[model samples]
Target chain A: MMEKYHIESYCRIKDQRISLNGATVFESAETNFLPFIKEAYKTLDTQYPKFFKMDALSKLALIASDLLLKNMTEKNIALVLSNRAASLDTDRRHQQSIEEADHYYPSPAVFVYTLPNICLGEISIKHRLFSENGFFVFEQFRADPLVDYADGLLKMQRAEKVLCGWMDLDNEKYDAFLYVVAKNGIFTHSKKKINQLYQTS
Target chain B: MNKVYLSYNNIVSGYGFDTAAAVEGIKKEDACLRQIHDKHLLPNHYCASKVASETLEEAYAQLRPKEAHTHLEKMLLVSLEKTIRASQLELTDRVGLIISTTKGNIDVLEPENPFPKSRAYLGQLGEKIRHFFGFQNEALVLSNACVSGVLAIAIAKRFILQGTYDEVFVVGGDLVTKFILSGFNAFQALSDEPCRPYDKNRSGINIGEVGTSVLVTKKTTHLAEESVVLLGEASCNDANHISGPSRTGEGLYRSIVAALAQSELNAGNIDCISAHGTATLFNDEMEAIAFNRSGLQNTPMNSLKGYFGHTLGASGLLETIIGMHSLHQNTLFASKGFQELGVSEPLNIIKKTTPKPIETFLKTASGFGGCNTAAIFKKVAEK
Candidate 1:
C-alpha cells in the first residue's frame, strides 16, 4: 500500500506571469525573459542580490521555489526538479567564450551555472534544506516519475516534504511548474492532479 | 520492501572495452592519463583518458549497431550491451533504463561537428540510447553534475523498492569535450599533468571519458561473478555554495551519516572508501574535512581518479564497479599518484596494492550543485 501525501502548494511561471494555487500573483509582458524575470524578482520584494548574478534558468527556479517555500515550516524539504535544456543556455555561452583563441576569455561566473542542478544548490542554500536534492532531465514534462519518487521519499522518511518541479529553458522559451508535497495538504498528490495543476497555469 | 543488488556491470573507457582491462592497468600502475595530440578531439594538448575512435569502433562493430550513432552513443551502447548480455534477462516493461551524463552529445552544438544540433539536447541523447536497446520505459536522463552516476543507482534502488520496476539498467558517461575542458580550464581547475589525488603536491583534475553500466534488481540469482548487495544510500545538499564545497563538509558528512544510519552500520564498520577526489585544492581539502568529521579519516580509501582521470558522470559508477571488484578480490588498490597527505585530515590513503580482507565499502560523490550522494555496498557470502 502506498502512503498518502498531498500537494500543499503549487506555482507556475510562464509567459511573464506568476500564478500560485490557480491565482495570478505577478505578471509582466516584457517579451524578454531577462526583463520579465527581473520584474518577477522585484514583485517578491526580496533582496538576495545573488539572484541577479544567476543565469535565467537558476533565476526562474529560485523564484518559483521561493514562492512555494517562503512560509513553509518544514525544514527537511527534499528538492526533485527536472528540466529539458539541462543548462544548454549557459553551455552555449561558455562554449562561445573560448571558441576563438584570439578572443578566449571564459569567466568562472558563467561557467559554474552550466550544470542543470545548480539551481537546486541555490534553493538548498536559501531554505537551509540539507535533505535529498536531485535534478533530472526529460524530453518533456512528465509528472509520474516526480510523483512516484517524491512519494517514496516521504514514505521512506527520507524527507518530511518534497518539492517536485519541471523547469526548462531553451531558445528564450521556458516554463516552470513547482509543487510541494507533504503528509497533509489541500489536494491528494497524484500524477493526474499534478498534470492538471501544471496545465492550470 | 525488496533488497536490490547491483548485479551485472561493465566499464568501457580508455584502458579498453572491458572492466578487467582497467583493473589490470591499475594493478600494474600503468599510466591511465595520456598525452592526446589529436586535432579532431581538441586543438590543445590534453591529459585525459579518452577512448580512441578505433578502440570504440572496433568494440562497437561487434554489436552490429545499425544507425549512425554519435561518439557518446557508441560508447554507451557498447557498455550497455555488455551488461545486458551478461545478465541474460528480458528487456520487458518491468525493466527501466537510465542514461546519466553531464553533457551528452554536447559536441554536436559545436560548429566543427556535423551532427544536428538536436543531438545536444539531453532528451535526444536519451532517446538514442533507449531506441537502440528497445527499453520498455521512456529512458530517464539524469544530468546532475558529477553526482548523476551514483545518484542514478540510488534512484534505481528506490524504483524497485517502490514497485515501480523490477530492474533498472543504469548507463552513465561523459566526454572530455572542449566545452568541459575550456569550462574547467576557465576555473583553472584542469591539471596539465596527470592528476595526483590527495597528494601533497597535487595539481587539478585530468578530465576523462568512460561509459559504464550496471543492473539493479531484487534477485540474487542474477548476480554477476562480482556483485554486491546495496545496503543503503542517501544524498544531501550542503546548502552552502553551488560551485564551492562547504568549509565544514556539512553536506557530505550528513550524507554519510544518513547512509550509515540506513545501512545499520557505524563509521567503524566501513572497510574501504572510493572517494570523489577530483584532485582540486578545494575538493580534496573538503573531502578530507568531511571524512574526518565522519570519523572515517583512517579508513583504507583510494581515489581511482589517477586510474580513470575523472570520468565525470561515469566516474562515480565506474569507481563503484571497481570497488565491487576490490571487495571480491579482497584487495586494496593503491591511491595512485599519492606520495604524502595533502589535506589537513589524517587519511589512510592506500599506498600499494595490498591484499586485505574487506567486505563493505562506501561510494561517495559531490558535485557542482552542492549535491552529495553516499552509497554503501557489501559483499554477499558464497553460496
Candidate 2:
C-alpha cells in the first residue's frame, strides 16, 4: 500500500504559484542563481562570502536544503532532488580541459560534481543527514512521481520527513523548488485527496 | 491500485535507435572496440572503446536545432522525437514528460564566460521542450547518477498508478564530454579496452553516451501487443560512501529485495537479470555479492556495456529497453566480452547465446554515490 504523506512547508524560486497546495512563500523571476542562493542562505542564517564560488545547482541545493534543515534536526532527513542539469560547473571544467590541449587535465574535485545527486551529498555533509539520500534527473519535473517518492519514503518509515524538489542550474539561471513531506496525522493526503488536489490545481 | 502498462520504448544509440536494427546488431555480436592507431590523439592508450560512428556533437547536430540549443537540449530533442514517434501519441495530450540525465547543460560553462548570474539556461531547457511538444501536463527532470533512467521509469509508474496523469513519457539521455572522459581517466576508472564485465582480466569502465525513452500509461488504456509492463522498482542509498559502493552491498541487497517483494515475485521468478556490469572491479564484485545475497545467483544475466560501453545515466533505460526487446523476441542476449570470471563468487554470466521463454526480467544499476536501483518488468500477454 502507498504511504500517506503531506507537504509540511514548501518553497519555490519561480515567478508564480505552480504548486497544487496553493502555497506560494516566495516568487521571483528577476533573481539570479546567486541572489536566490543568498536569499535562501539568509533564511538559514549563514554568511555567503562573495569569493565562495561553486556550481549554481550546488549552491542552490545547499542553501535550500539548509533552510529545510534549519527548522528540523538533521538526524533522519533524506535529500532527494530532481533536476535537469546534474552539475554544470564540473561539466564546464571538464570541457575546458579538452578544449585547451596544452593544459588538459581533469580535476577529480570538479569531476565528482558531474553526478546529478552530488547536491544531496553537499546537503548531507552540511546538515549531517546520515539517512537515505539520492538524486533523480528527468527531461522535466513531474509532480506525481515526486509525490509518490515522498509517499513511499514515509510509508516505509524510512525517515520522519523527506526533503524533495526540483533543482536545475544552467548558465545564468537557476530554479530551486522544494517541499518537506511528512507522515504527521494532522497534514496528510490520501490517494483520493491527492487526485483531487491535482484536479483542482 | 491501478495497473500501469509500459508502452513504447525507443533508444538512439551508436548501434542505431530502431529496435529491430539494434537487435540485429546485438545478434551479430559485433564488439564496438577499436585500436587507437592515431598517436596524435593519445599515444600511450593502446585501446579505447567508443560508440560506433558520430561523436556526441555530431549526433546533436543531426537533430537540426543547430543554434539555439546546448548539447543537453539537442539530446533531449532527439530522444523525445524517437519516443514520441514510437508512442504515436499526440504531444498536446494531457501527459507528463519525465526526463532523466546526469549532466544537463553543465557543458555550457566555460572559463571565459563561466556560469551566468541568471542560471535560466537550465529552466529554459525544460520549458522549451514543454513548449515544443505542447504537453499540457507537467515536465520533470530526474538527475540522479547512473541510476537516473530507471528511477525515471519508476516515478512514471507511480504517477500513472496514482492517477496523477493518464500517460507519462520517460526519457533518459547523456552525452560523452571531455569532462567526463578526462575525469574518469583521472580516477583511472576508464577501461583502455572495451569493457569486459565479470571477466578475470576486466580492468575498468569505458565511458559511452546514449539516449532512450519510454511511454507509460494506466492499464485502462489499451496498448499494442509489444508494450511491456513495469511491475515494480526500488531505490536505496548505502549512505556508506560518496563515490563508491558499500562492499557489503547492503543498500543494493535491500533495494533488490524490496523490488522483488513489491512485485510479489520470488528470486526464482526472475528469468534474467541485467547486471550493472561496468567492468570496474569494485562494482562487479559488489554486484556479485548483492546478487548472491538476493539469492539470484542462478539467474542468467548479462551486461550490455560491452556493446555500448558504460552509458552512465542512459544505461538504466537503454539496457531496460534491450531487456524488453529480448523478452519480446524470446532470445537471451550474451554477456558481451565475458571470457573469465573475476569475482570470488561465481556468477551465472550468460556467455553464449541462448533461448528462453522470458516472461519476467530484472534490471539493476549502481552508481558513484552508493545509489542502487532495481526494476522488474513482466511480459504483457497479447489481448
Which candidate tops TM-score? Answer: 1
**For each candidate, what TM-score against the reference?**
0.98, 0.79
Once superposed on the true structure, which residue ranges of model 2 sit more than 4 Å away at CA? A1-78, A82-86, A94-98, A122-160, A166-179, A185-201, B35-79, B105-122, B220-222
What would the per-residue lDDT of candidate 2 be over residues B1-383, giving only the tens digit for each residue?
56777777666666665556666778778765554544334324634444444455665566666346655555566767777876678765558887676765544444443445223234455566776667886567666788887877887886665556778888776665555666787778877788899999997877676667778887445475567778888877775655777888876897899899988999999999988999989899999999999999989999988888887777898888889888888888999889989998868999987887889999999886677889999988856
Measure candidate 1: CA RMSD. Answer: 1.2
Fraction of the real A/B interface contacts present in each candidate? 0.86, 0.45
Residue range B246-330, candidate 1, lDDT tens digits: 8998999999999999999999999999999999989999999999999999899999998789888888889999999999999
User: Where does candidate 1 stray beyond 4 Å?
Assistant: B37-45
lDDT of the candidates, in the order given? 0.90, 0.70
Q: Which ten residues in a row have the lowest lDDT in candidate 1 chain B?
A: B37-46
